[model samples]
Target: MALTGETSTQLALRDPDIRLMLRVRDDDAEAFAELVELYHHRLVTVMHHLVGNAEEAEDLAQEVFLRVYRGRKKYHPKAKFSTWLYTIANNLALNILRTRQRKPTIPLNVRDSGPLGPRPAEQLVLDRHAQPEDRIQQQELAAVVKQALETLNERQRIAVVLNKFEDMNYAEIAEVMGLTTKAVKSLLSRARDNLRVVLQDYIHMNEPGQERKDEG
Candidate 1:
């Protein structure tokens, strides 16, 4: 449904990022810079997950910002600012994925700051007092999880990324992906199922009930 003008204004008032976006629409360079600073790392991280290459992710992230700046004059708050921003990122990431003939390989040494926070695989990271061997095990498990994420199809991966990393609900993810809320739910469900199968072996390595705590 199209948002009524009054509802749009209410959303804008409620979200500080929307207000910053409003400032950007007015050609406020500082506001644009602030928005870039706020989201640059996050966007790059997400793009890295999507494209599976640091260089391509960085370039794609910069392009997303550039598109934002170029289209600033047309900005309007139809939804949360992050939603609009991610919509752009999603479109770009999909384009990149579609153009590739083969799927990219995920690195074994995946970064600690991955999406889905500390699920079963991440839980392998014990306390600060953990021994070096344990830390190494944790890193290995995390990489396996990352590789599992890469196994998902593009749409499923995008849905999982937005839901887990961006903390978006089904409705928000649907808006970004141009799917119905039900479709987003289905996508995440399948993604969870796939991950569960791929990561089953590692789940036992974590403490009890660690896998059950997964959100989205």
Candidate 2:
């Protein structure tokens, strides 16, 4: 059966796990397992982007789920399930990045590859075919962007991940991160400025005669 939005919402509303989660507040092992199955892959994907290593990302994702399972009794519906899930993910990723002694090695232009999904290069080519120089510049630009993201303060990085990648608005981001809307805006502003500076040369080189636009 295809998982359409309506069907997914209905499943969520009627999901034994969600209902189990309500029971989890009272301590239910079965419900916890259900939540695990539902969120594990998503959590792993988020962690991989933040932590930059599949093995570590998987470990971190497991830890997040473990925390949720252990803290089930304390679960509250102050936000959507996804927001709460991502909040835990964001915190864990930041902590991992903080405690590590070695800085993460930012990868250059590595395209996404999946068994069932279109390859990253294929997707890019389909969107826009470019000359060899353009391709090189694009890869360099992506590398700079990734490096710049690594340099953001933990909170700022989380904000950008949510805002840009997750397409969350300020209110949603604030709710997920437990910050005020104004604070979320400020964090994103600082992150954008930093990225602009870090990627200035790439932007200028790519745009040719155009002045670089301010990052929103």
Q: Considering every candidate listed, which one attains the maximal TM-score?
A: 1
lDDT of each: 0.78, 0.67
lDDT of 1 by residue, 1-216 (tens): 224565767977888888998899998999999999999999998998887779999999999998998888888787778888998999999888877725434333454435644543345333323543355365565666676786788899999988788888898889889999998888999999988876665666676654334545
In angstroms, give how far residue 34 of model 1 lies from its true place.
0.7
The local lDDT score (0 to 100) that residue 87 gets in candidate 2 is 78
Q: Which candidate's lDDT is highest?
A: 1
Q: What is candidate 1's CA lDDT for residue 137?
A: 65
**Once model 1 is optimally superposed onto the true structure by TM-score, how far is the C-alpha of residue 97 displaced, in angstroms?**
1.5
- Tally clashes: model 1: 0
Model 2 off-target regions past 4 Å? 1-20, 26-30, 101-142, 204-216
lDDT of 1 at 127: 33
The deviation in Å at residue 159 for candidate 1 is 0.6
- For residues 74-112, what per-residue lDDT tens digits would candidate 2 score against the true structure? 775544566767877877776777776255344334343
